[model samples]
Target: MRRIPVRSLAVLATVGTLVLTGCGTETGDPADSTPAVAGADRTIRAHEVMQLTKVHEETGMTLLEGPTFDGTGKLLVVDVTAPAGKPKVIRVDVRKRTSQAVHTDARGAYTSAQFSPYDGRLYLTDYAHGEVVSLAPDGSDPRTFFSGDVDGARMNPDDIAFDEEGNLYVSDSRGLSTGDAHGRVVRIERDGKESTVLAEGLASTNGVSFDADYEGLWISELTQNRISYLRLDGKGGVASKHTAVRVDGGIAQTDSIAVDAAGNIYQALHGRAAMVVYDRHGERLATIEVPARAKGLESATNVAITPGGTRAYMTVSGPAGGFLYTFDALAKGVRQSNGG
Candidate 1:
């Protein structure tokens, strides 16, 4: 339902329309609106799994973003707001509730991370440098992997995903802040030699995750607070796409996203300290929020379901600092939820 003119109706030429496939869902007013994720599928009270930032930030606050599982079941997260002296990438021990540094570039602000199943290397998106860098599983051999461009314009990449065949898809999040259609979903070929703009013309593309079958993509556009399903053409490009879900509320923007084995989408909200679980059809399943006692935690920036199960961990941050919260997921975890 339209809470208040959430987005502009203008469409962009660079974007692929779902009208061709007749599967596109559009935003509507509350009077004629599609059912919003009313309250939630189930109100799940998440407990404190671990804390990364400080309880009270008398100085600077840490903004924790990406939360994903590496190959060996380590909970990896990124401090997008870390200063020079702090670790940008941190790996957590799920069993013991401990943390350790992975890697961080002095000049780069990495936002999201994923392990490439194809090559078994950890790939991270440096939002500040417009580059995708890779490191070994143990956080060694850090190097610039993909700084490719789209239509000759430098990409302000946000999040990333890898297809079954190893094609890298990125969310180019430079949107309204620059101009219309600047936001794009670019595909960097598996070989890393060529890149293509799979989709474009949006607000701010944030989350990037592939469907269970690898034939479609689930993307969240932040400025508009909506999520769309991008059906692939099977050759590393989007065939058609449609607006599948929209998060309507006060100043709430969608951040990172994860998909479980059954294809449920776990999307985080930056302004609100809660995560929404939506089915493949864009129906809301649950809303996982920190209990009222957990004060100072402002937002749930990103979430990752524990590999092989429904245990979900969210990377939260605010004036209280960065922290990790746990929840019982709606379905089993899969490749999409574990990776980036």
Candidate 2:
């Protein structure tokens, strides 16, 4: 198998930075401040007031992505250090402010790992291997849960999510360097059968999440710098689709996303160095800024809201190093079906 060259991957990595910093007018003037909440009488400057605490910091790790809470309240994150070193999943104890490796042997970079409510198992995306793997909640009993092809093409699963019925949805980002429109969102049935739900003109599908009401599936397209919501038919197929939110300028590369009980959407804006919050109607609510000069914490790649939604955990990756950060959230996160 021919690997996408590291240099090409680097080019893809820089897309967010260039879009966020180089695109003028798209971001507007930094001084032109406006209230985040629609129709609110007073402006709440969350970007300037929210305090961010460094939870865990590590050197030598290049890319950090995916973040989910375990049943025990520990946070699990993937270090996507491909070609340079073996990727591993690190488990963090939020209260203790400590972290440890709970799972290794990625075979390829691990993009996302989600716990299932029905079976009490961890489902992870093996990006380079084109498969989804499962593990015991404690990171044991690793096995391939789904692999091979989807819609007649290989899978490069980047993110995973589960519905109330226990079915799994995965975002397959075929490749980053190429401009081919091969991105797809696939569903793994309760019985393990796979089907493609959305596969049309997507440029590197990166994230997947369901709304609080379970009425729509939200996805982030990295290269396109937009997030969309897909209304699904009763039979696990897309009924209709529409753009929910888009990064107009200043680093439009949106990565992973999470939702709160109040229907607020938390998005990782890679190039802007911030996590953005949006109402269910796709209106901008707040911007949680991640410091740009923080040695190893440059880009915000993924976000996970804890069970109560009172706090949010984010992963930052860049040349300096990889680290996990946490901060108080304005809204409570919706509890996952599995109690994660």
Candidate 3:
């Protein structure tokens, strides 16, 4: 299929600069397009859906790719500085809709955050420093956990995830203009042993996650407008990999993703100011619309779900600075719920 182009394509790399550029010129065109669903031994429904409500304009914290919540229900977000400024991490109280700057350093820009399954510590990546650091929630001295230059890959560490076995996965996205075969996913073990390259030739793989069954891995391809799945056979690595879902009229720039308890996958389709949900079979279940009140969410980078599964938290970048929004998902047994 032709490359899906929505709202995410132009923002991932230029987010810091473009978010301040205003929600670009409106095209005045309809927002309907067909998406591609790819995978092994599976075929799924492919298309885009419309929103039933206006975009929620409420603001929380300024972050690039976050809203990651902890066991305590506290959501941590990314603050990519104030328009070409510095970077920091902010904590958002979901219950009160209030936020506080947990760690704001004018000298560093932290791109992504992941909580270690085995230790519960926070693992953060610095795009500019080419380093990954870990800090306790108590805000102690941040220590270098992993550091490597992405020079040969033409990429940087963006988002991260953890498998059921406590393994760490990092998404290495190629530069703005690059294509698949450039993005990389690296796996880090508990002993700090690292093995790189799970799948190669992905069109900007930025976010990744495994299904509830832990049988398959899902990755967000920013430049390809599709989610790829890799099946796990034994453990050493993925047995095979293939495209799982493609968003029609969707931007190739997909950033972050999360999978619910039922095998449903949630992906942030950046640039287009939208979130897409896909079933286990790779069908597009629903597309959550984001109102572009500011920079049109240059790169809607990360996604988080409350432990209760009642809402999904998203981070978007714009001229008004980075903002976060919560999407109310209907409770499972609540009849008459639209799953909105």
TM-score per candidate, chains pooled? 0.85, 0.80, 0.74
**Tens-digit per-residue lDDT, 1-340, candidate 2:** 2234221112222211110111000111223344355433223222221112222232223566777888788888776654323337778886666777777761445777788878988887777667788889888899888888877787777788788887888887765557566778888885676566565668778778888888778888877778888898877788898888886636346777777777777777665456777777877767766443354444677777778746666676555456666555656766431121
Instruction: Report the lDDT tens digits of candidate 1 across residue range 73-184.
Output: 8888887756555687899997788999887655666778888878988888876557888889888999888785668887877788888777789988765343455688
Kindly give the stretch of ten consecutive residues in candidate 3 with the minimal lDDT sum. Answer: 331-340
Which residue pairs of candidate 2 clash?
A: 19-251, 20-250, 20-251, 309-332, 309-333
- In model 1, the clashing pairs are 41-285, 41-286, 181-201
Lowest lDDT sum, 10 consecutive residues, model 1, at 17-26
Model 3: C-alpha RMSD to truth?
Answer: 8.8
Best by TM-score: 1
TM-score of 1: 0.85
Model 3 scores a C-alpha lDDT of 0.56
Please identify which of the two predictions, 2 or 3, would achieve the higher TM-score against the true structure.
Answer: 2
